[model samples]
Target: MKSERERQLMEQAYAEIEKYQDLVHRDPYRLRYHLMPPVGLMNDPNGLIDWNGTYHVFYQWMPFRTGHGAKFWGHYTSPDLVHWQAEPIALAPSEWYDQNGCYSGSAIDDDGKLVLFYTGNVKDDQGNRQTYQCMAVSEDGIHFTKKGVVINLPDGYTAHFRDPKVWRKDGLWYMIIGAQSKSGDGKAVLFRSSDLCHWEHLGPIAGGNSKWLGPFGYMWECPDLFPLDGQDVLIVCPQGLQPDGMRYQNVYQSGYFVGRLDYGRAEFVHGPFEELDRGFEFYAPQTMLDRNGRRILIGWMGVPDQNEDRQPTVGHRWVHALTLPRELRLVDGKLRQTPVKELKQLRKQQVAYPNAVVANELRSWPGVEGDAIELRLDRIQLLGSMMEIHFRHAARLIYNSDEGVLTLERKSFVNGLTETRQCRLPRLRSLHVFLDTSSIELFVNDGEETFTARFFPYPDDRTMFFGAHGHLQMDIEKWEL
Candidate 1:
């Protein structure tokens, strides 16, 4: 039963919805085609599934303010993954098990009904935390009936265990959860169930305790295990990760391991962990197979404990958005992700410039500037040591051919100083850039690597400049989204 506290929270959320809608109506940094909270704050796309011919996405949402607190599962439905409509809030943190928050989880279609498996978080008077693996069911994919806690905390692990990802394989249900041991080390535990409720623990598959992976991270937050192109993939977000050169530069790290899962032994024989996104603002990515059999994934476009108050959108009463829905493919034992084809519906007023020359000076082309747009550069030959793309004078994308490194530079809101994040690539060929009002996604070389980040540019500054130290030939296309 929904409690009085939940009812009061819902009323406040609705009131803030109306107020934030009016307040952000004139906000210039609002996203045009991305999914963002209507009010307050949003993080970690959860319960992603395709049910009964429609797409459903739930996110960790706190609707009363711009900070993290008791979270509700905010809902959104899409017919083609391009157009989206906000639905009513799903799960509220009102029950005894979830008094603190309803954390991240997954969704599954069970016999024509939608079943949501999530984590219910609680903390007691002494500040001791508790967690439960819970479930809820929806017949019409709109309204849901909470099933409460189905799986409790087992021995040897602390309450940091959460974010259960469930899937059915070979007529048996399997789950993978991110967990922290009582000793405070990251782990991914495996479980199996004949029904969806009662589960049997299968022990840790790969984590800090493993011989190959020694001392990985302090804690793991969101864990997802799935089969992609004949290989098993484990996706997780590990907090308190120290930087490894260009990797793990953010406060936390989200990445995946490609391997084969031995169901008999419940072991994952895998490769080294590789980061999924090399960006400043990416975490807690979740993936699901759609009706078309495509492994589509979305990630939160903001990181935790980094630049929270520094975000300019907090003044407008909202922050954070989901990355563009990307289709994942396994090519040459590496995961390749590209923007979904349905996003093409947003393309309009296309402009193409073939074989353009970039000399020593910055140059702008006609119809090459907009806040909401898609830019593609292809078939390029670099004759210079350095090349750069200035995005509205607020952000910069630069490539140095000599070092084989591509860099993104932007002014930090905390100290008003320039900061950069970069990744090394073999060569420069093509780039696909998606620009929203407050976000940017750069897919390099047909999704060999991608950089996703949030940027705040002036409303009137819609100019883009491209330049090279020497000279080069390139083809360019821009479409207003």
Candidate 2:
């Protein structure tokens, strides 16, 4: 049931992938166990769902060049979260309504069939833009049928309205979309559908200049709303927030507000916003509930338009990846992210040190070094005010117990100068570190605080250094992942 134009463009995208197969595979910086594009640019994980015992992940892909343009919905499927297989392209910019691009949205299961909701991006010769909330369906989760536009541009909002996240609540289908008001303030709009085809607008639930917040940002992108623990969480990316002290330091910010949603009145009463990840890269996260009843999350490891020209992977016709699937737990008022237990299957070599002590001078353990591995330290008792662990001489994780601050430092992608990002931690207990070829994911104090970043270090340098102003004791374990 595919249109002629849609079928042709998807074939072209497959051909593009085949053309760069060798070049892309030969890149030294390619991820070892992460989901990356076969070629071109990738961003904003979309349509994540666990349907019929299989996990499906789709994303925004530009297949022809290492830059952003009209995107194709590239897909990957997994029986288990650790192993993945690339499937056919889900949506192409072929239909007239979506000829510009098939942008971000979510997925759902409807009567044993897989349903997808996405933004149909259209543009005219003069570069004017129009957006449509569109739908598609698949029998096998591989090929999608474009149902065309189901909803038009509503009144009082700009065409920036996109990234619809839908869920079934109280036997009704509800969707929340990121939007820009006519007055140029960001917001999240609410809608309801009885049959997933017809919809009724429920007005704005939350965002800038709404019931609670002031003018926060000009445009909000990629919104997600779901119930976690005993409360509701709304995650969104808001643009145009200037840096205030230690937070909102990125080009933009991705964070959440915990509150209660009144479905009857279409209102969301929430608390203050808190930053999601204290890292250099981590944004546009999507989540799903698996059969095991775990709320798992994944995010794009690169920010939008943040030193894209400096990315080394583009030389090989590939750039960017999605982070490892992380299990989410709402702890003490904030969400805690930890690597799913399935990732332990990637562990190969095991190295452990019991009651290891480090003091004064920098030192290296005999077998604690690799470009791709996981390091776990438990029951760490610091005898000094400060301790520093350097990774491959490329990045450093420093903790100061006296100042109650933990800092992550790495060389800048734009300039070689050292750059640092910090978050407050009452005390340091455990440090879990994952090191990939060109990236790092640091989970501190049992996921109470986490830092995720991508840094390019010397490929040959796999040594790690640990130093302390005074003696510290801890249990250490390392595994090659």
Candidate 3:
């Protein structure tokens, strides 16, 4: 049975769809194969926790329009991370407290029940922002019950207090919420809650030291902290950072720092800032510890700075997706990301090409036309640093070993929009690149690093290309996603 709030939000969403049905929708910014909606605008991934033997993923969903409005918690579950089952709307902004929207938050297991803690966004007559931290409980792992505001915005904190992520340590509950400093700097606040209702501020964790942290914008959204291999890692998506050469190109981005948490002192000390994923579109990432004690992370594939109204898929009906969950490990002071091994279930026929194929010019491969294909290149020799692997036309991903760069360029779509992102990798040998019709996941050097992105292309542009400035030899294998 649908709740009154759910029904109202559905009606409003449908009405908005009808109102904007005629307009040309924009293409989603995420790459193909990532878990994007068939249509609509998507943002921060929320409620990304394993409960009741199923992995539940909820996101900031705006169904009827192409932008953020009257947000609802869209639900999807997967026995494994590869195959996801889309469920109904979980939470709606039907109540007065959260009428404006139900913003981003996280999930936890209270005993055996699934508990969701989220932000209740409200606006007054003058359109001022009033945010409240609310709670909800789910029994069947599908439907949710709204439990009114559990924690209100304390004094000295601005309306930016949102995206609460909770965890248990030493039988005490701890939460990290993204917020802005009184000086208008982006920060994340830690709170201690014994019962999930009353929260006591633990003060700032890692955003105060400007020398090491830089001026990290005004607010850090979706802050996730976890223990990775004897080190505590803090992942934060901060806004208002100036682009330093190739870094922080996206309007907002996600990154992390290896640090130590001094719970007694109510402070966290960390090293310099480093990006979580060096990709074109990854933001508002959330992390949780599974039963196996592994810290798995997932992120929203779209950024708030990019406009999705111009994407072609909006005309068809969906916008963003979640990046494949990655197992994060801190190795020698560096964070290593590898796609969860459980994703192997998604691999059907394993096509192996052992012999190195040397090509002086561009070449094509047969049987690689499907919307999903996994390419594994063993010992790829990029004779010239300037080379590209083209997929589905208009989209070319280049790897420049000399410059330690990997770039994915998409043109001829979205009114000819082009974007490039690069990370420092001394030399590239083995490359595992996953290509879905609308998404791309690049695992460089056996997941020592990864770059996940989403893109949209016309149906006729489905072609693959391997271009080299000089002679190149690579062992390639393509798999159906």
Candidate 4:
């Protein structure tokens, strides 16, 4: 038996399939299973709210087209965050105020009701952008009713004001929106609201002419602010930042800054910018408070401005997916991310390595073939100049201490595009990696820093290898997906 709302959603989904049958019917991407979207093109996560034993996540979805066009709010709900149920389209850009698209925003549970706040994007006849801060409400957590604009673009702020992340502080509601300065600098502004209907600008929280904060591109997008280990952490994905040394490698990347907030003075005292994830694919991360009072985060696994048309799964209808929710904690003044323990529910067969296994030369683990698996390598002794690990098909991951590079190479992608990123390390000792069918997450030095990537593999590429010239020792544990 299905509820009326569930049946209505089913009918709506069927109708959508019929309407966009040409574009909606495609194969799934070949990357780790966690990185590829289950159905359609998905980007930034919006309206992440945990309410009444269920979690609702809205994303930047494009329904009618295969690429990024006609942005609509796609909804998904999960009781445990591992398995998701697709719901109806929460918001469509069918109205005048949001005819162009409905951009990214946040959600909150206001006294038992789910309140969604998102940016209503509008473009005029000249193709100029107009952003509006809008509101919606849901009682059953599946359907939403728009409440029009709650805040408008203010003076001194450019038209790029979008991605409003709302939170409750003390006794009032506060929002942090990504924006650009008049001189074309990226920043995030704060706002306050006594009632959900009215709002007041509180000026910039950070990212406006700081000596240490570098020119973080033109405008920051998807601003997320939360408290971790007694310090406020701000995560923002900025555009136009050129690669300087080992930072800002992706077309667009997400990072964070740990700081203290003085709400009375409307200012944020922060530290230098730090890359959140050192992976090939990760962008526009969103965070929320779960039922256990933990701050968990999820990020889009695809980069912006990349040639995704070459993705193998384009024929399958979906493109990207959200990373597994990770709990954030501040350790020794640095943000450490770890997968929640709930993910263990998805694990089946477990293989343990009780004693240290030496791979002085290249070694292979039999039956280590699957799209989904959890691997833990402890006390890794890298005695060679370089060592490589292969997953899926031609996905090669190398940790080279001699060259100070940790590279993930995928030659099987569209047009044989192989992307690699490296960070300077004194010496590589230990590595912990998680591999899903279409995604790979590497946690180095026990979560001191991490990398997240999405890869598309060929159907027959399930073999893995550990290649090294000199002696190497490691304790490896493999678990079924």
Candidate 5:
């Protein structure tokens, strides 16, 4: 049963949304193929699941402003991930335990019902924080009934424990949470449950003074554990990761660890933590296996603690959008992410270029200029030290053969000055670029490395230039998304 306060909040939220719809839609930076809040702010993709032939995704939303506050679980649903519709709010922070916010979490199919697991965040008047692993049930996958707190904050962790990702394996339900130890180190704690409502604390399976993994971060925000090709993968976002050469440049980092999880001992024997995206704007990624048995992931396309005010969309009363859904695969012991195959459904007005030779100067393509389109430069013969693709005069993706590094450069949203983020690659193979209205995602070498960022060029500036220092050969294909 819904309380009167929750009902009133919903009514007011709908009114605010209606009032801002036109203003928000008028923003030129509005995305054509990305999931964004109709109003206010969005972060951290949450409660991702495939249920009854529908793809459901939820996010942390602050509908009243383009900043953080008491959050609600905003939802979207689709028959396929390619096309989506904003659904009614799934979970609200109206109850006593969750009055402050309903933070990030995941979802699962409990028998036939859609069950969601998330963190309820509360801050008392004294500034002390409290967290609870909460659950909700949805018969129709739209409206969710709150089941209150299922698991309180366990011992040895601070209130930073949140973002519960629950999955079932071997006839038992398991959960992993992002946490900060009382001693101020990041950790991923484990739990088990036979029934969805009752959970058993299984201790810290990864992070926090582990012998195999050294001190990684001060606090881990979102941890997701799943299976990929017979091996377990743990995806997490850790805060306070200092810059390590070309990686960990952002305020926080989201990455994964490929390993084996010992069920009985509740331990994850894994390799070194690897950054999932070698980019500036990918975080809090969540994955779910689809009906076709493919593991797919989606991430928030903006970074936190960065240029919050400088985003042009904030003037229109919205902040961030989700990345295009990407399919995840374990290739050669590394996670390879490619845009989901269903996105081909959005392709239209195909254009192709035969194998082309490039010289020292950048050249623009006549048919490949658009704010929202897909471009593929394949079969590349890299005969140059540097290959550059200038995106709309605002951002550029540069490949340097000398250092074997791929760099993305863009004007800082804060200072309007040029900045760059880079990652090392062994060799160059192909470049797959997806350009939405205000964002760009570069999938390099068939998704071996990806760079995701939001770049706001002038609305009319759709020109892209391709340049090589010496000479390179590649084919190009593009489709308006």
Candidate 6:
């Protein structure tokens, strides 16, 4: 039964939505083709699953305001990824187990019912934190029945344990949870269950101060474990990583490890963690296998504790959004992400400039710019020492072929200064860019590397400038999306 408190919280959230949704929608910086909250702050993509030909996406939402607080699970359903419909709120923090918040988790289809396993967050008067691994079931995938707590605090761990990612393997159910050890080291542990209720601890599978990893981070949040191709991939967000040049530059980092998971030993022998995105925004990504046998992943377009108060959309009563759904693949032992093909359905008014050439000067193409557009540059060649593309004078993509480095610079929302993110690449090739009203996603060299950022440019400044120090050649295509 849904608790009365849960029902009351849900009603309050709906009231917030009904009161401020229109006001939020009037913001010019609102996204054109992405999932955003109705009227408040949103973080972490949670409970991602594809069930019965419909895709369900749940996210962490703070409905009363544009700041993080007691979170509710906001729901959205999509027949095709290009179109999304907002569903009723999924889970609320009404029950005692989850009175504080309903945090991140995963979903699975079991016995013709949709099963959701998520973390219940709680805090006491002295601000002591408590956590529980809880479950819920829905026959129609709409209304849900909470199953309360299934797993309590395990021995030798703090209340920081949360974000359960579960899967079925070899006729048994297995789960990997993001946690922090009692010693304050980050960990991803394993557990097993015959039924969905009772769980048996299987010890830490992979974490800091274990095996080759030493003193990695203070906490690990939002861990996902799955098999791709012939190897297992573990994706996690680790906090307390100091900056190592261009890496670990954000407050937290989300990356992955590819290795083998030994079920009997409950150990994961993996490789070094590689940053999933090299941009200012992107955290707590979740993936689900679609009907096409593709691994589709989406991430929160904003990071925690990163210029949240400075966001322009917050004044309108909503903040943060989700990145485009990208299909994940393992190519040459590294992850490759490209916008899912279904997004092409949003393409309209195709415009192409074949062999657009520039030399020793900056210029603009006749019809190659818009605030919301899909720009594709094919067979790109850096005939000069450098090539730069400036969008609306707010963000710039610069490639320094001499240094073999690509850099993204955007005007800071807080200080009005130019901020840059750089990653070393051997050479330059093609560029696929998605320019939304207030964001840009750069997929370079056929998803070889990707950069996602949120920028607030003047609505009228849709001009794009291409500069080549010496010479450049490429075929460009623009589609208003």
- RMSD (CA, Å), candidate 2 to true, equals 1.0
Ranking of predictions according to TM-score: 6, 5, 2, 1, 4, 3
lDDT of 6 by residue, 111-208 (tens): 88999999999999999999999999999888888999999989888899999999899999998899999999999989999898999999888999
lDDT by residue for model 1 over 1-481, one digit each (tens)? 4567777767778888997798866678989999999988899999999888889999999988899987889999999999999997788888898888888999998888899999999989898999999999888888777898989999989889999999999999998999998888899999999889899999888788686587889798899988899999889898888998898889999998899889888888888888888777999999999999999999999998898767999999888999999999999888998999999999999999999999998999999999999999999789989999999888899999999999999877677678888899979899999999878899999999999898877878898999899897899999999
lDDT of 3 by residue, 6-40 (tens): 68886776666566544423433334345665347
User: How does each model score on lDDT?
Assistant: 0.90, 0.91, 0.78, 0.78, 0.90, 0.92
Error of 3 at 232 (Å): 0.7
Alpha-carbon TM-score of each model against the true structure: 0.98, 0.98, 0.92, 0.92, 0.99, 0.99
Best by lDDT: 6
Q: Looking at model 5, report the run of 10 residues with the lowest lDDT sum.
A: 1-10
Tell me which of candidates 2 and 3 scores higher on lDDT.
2
Candidate 1 global TM-score: 0.98
Residue range 315-427, candidate 2, lDDT tens digits: 99998999889998999889998999999999999999999999877898988999999999999999898999999888999999899899999988778899988999989
Candidate 6 regions with alpha-carbon error over 4 angstroms: none
Which sections of candidate 2 miss by over 4 Å? none
Which residue runs of candidate 3 sit more than 4 Å off their true CA positions? 1-7, 10-34, 208-212
